[model samples]
Target: MASSDTKDISYEDLKALLGKSENLFLVDVRSKEEVDKGQIQGSVHIPVDTVEAAFAMAPEQFKAKYGVTKPLLEAPELVFHCQMGKRGAAATTKACELGYVNARNYTGGYKEWSEKGGK
Candidate 1:
């Protein structure tokens, strides 16, 4: 597990991280309607309301449902984002409480991502 003193990740850091590795796991913790409009490429949708239960599921079940591997507790980059920043921060807290110490909230969220030219 990578140790990060900060719980929040800025858009610049996120963009750089995405550029550097495919190992990063991006979770979109937005509403279904919000997600239907668009989302960060390669991100898996897990609405904020279901974050706790979703993280509690077995890896196989999570993969089956989300069509992506469930992030391991020790993974270096387990990032969450919402339409804005609030829900992502909340979801990051939930993940940390569930033992995902490396979890981080993308503080700028989707709005910033889009405005900043993120794919």
Candidate 2:
């Protein structure tokens, strides 16, 4: 599991991941309805609610639905986001507790992303 105060990336670094195809996993921990408003171009949506419900319910379903091919990575750097970072931080904490070695919370979140003119 990752440390609670582990290193975290800036929004610019987050954008660079998408552009450079870094081995980072961007997880949008927002709901479907909120996602309908807007989202990062290639984020994988895994609602905080769903995670709270059960992290092990149909891993294949999440992968297939999200089109991610990576194996269940316990060590990948997972960047989590929500509307304003609150939920994302919770999800990040949970991810770390569940053995994700590198879990991050984007505090700026979608709201800040949009404020910065990101689509």
Candidate 3:
């Protein structure tokens, strides 16, 4: 996670990265209510409803308030997804602004990902 801009990645690329134990960070930007149905395995939860608030709150405060930890700088890639991909793209942009070099949005998002049965 560096100060490089966030980019969008293809489903194939995401699948390839997920295949390895590489430090790719998958962030699910969907809401908790949304996730109550289902979510991507191994993905971190940071509901879109609280993303801005979580970032605004300092690490300690954020954790105390919402139980979220700060970013792990060692991860070279960060992938964000939402129900339909709009919020995911916006979140990715914000993550890039916050210094995550490899932030990416899965445009196909949860709907498509799930429909593909995890591909």
What digit string (tens of lDDT, one per residue) describes model 2 on residues 9-101?
678878777787657778898889999988998788888977643454466765666678432546455788998888888887786677666
Candidate 3 clash pair list = 2-99
Task: List ranges where model 1 is wrong by over 4 Å.
Answer: 1-6
Candidate 3: worst-modelled 10 consecutive residues by lDDT: 66-75
Global lDDT of model 3: 0.76
RMSD of each: 2.7, 2.5, 3.4
Clashes of each: 0, 0, 1
- Sort the predicted structures by lDDT, highest score first: 1, 3, 2
- What is the overall TM-score of model 1 with all chains considered together? 0.92
What is the lDDT of every predicted structure here? 0.90, 0.75, 0.76
On the 0 to 100 scale, the lDDT of residue 87 in model 2 is 88
Off by over 4 Å in 3: 1-6, 55-69
Per-residue C-alpha lDDT of model 1 across residues 1-119, encoded as one tens digit per residue: 33434399999899989899777999999999999988898889999999999999999999899988898888899999998899998899889888897899999999999998898
Best by lDDT: 1
Best by TM-score: 1
Q: Which ten residues in a row have the lowest lDDT in candidate 1?
A: 1-10
User: Model 3, range 8-89, lDDT digits (tens) per residue?
Assistant: 7777777778899467778899988888889878777888666666555667886676554665533577789998889998
Off by over 4 Å in 2: 52-61
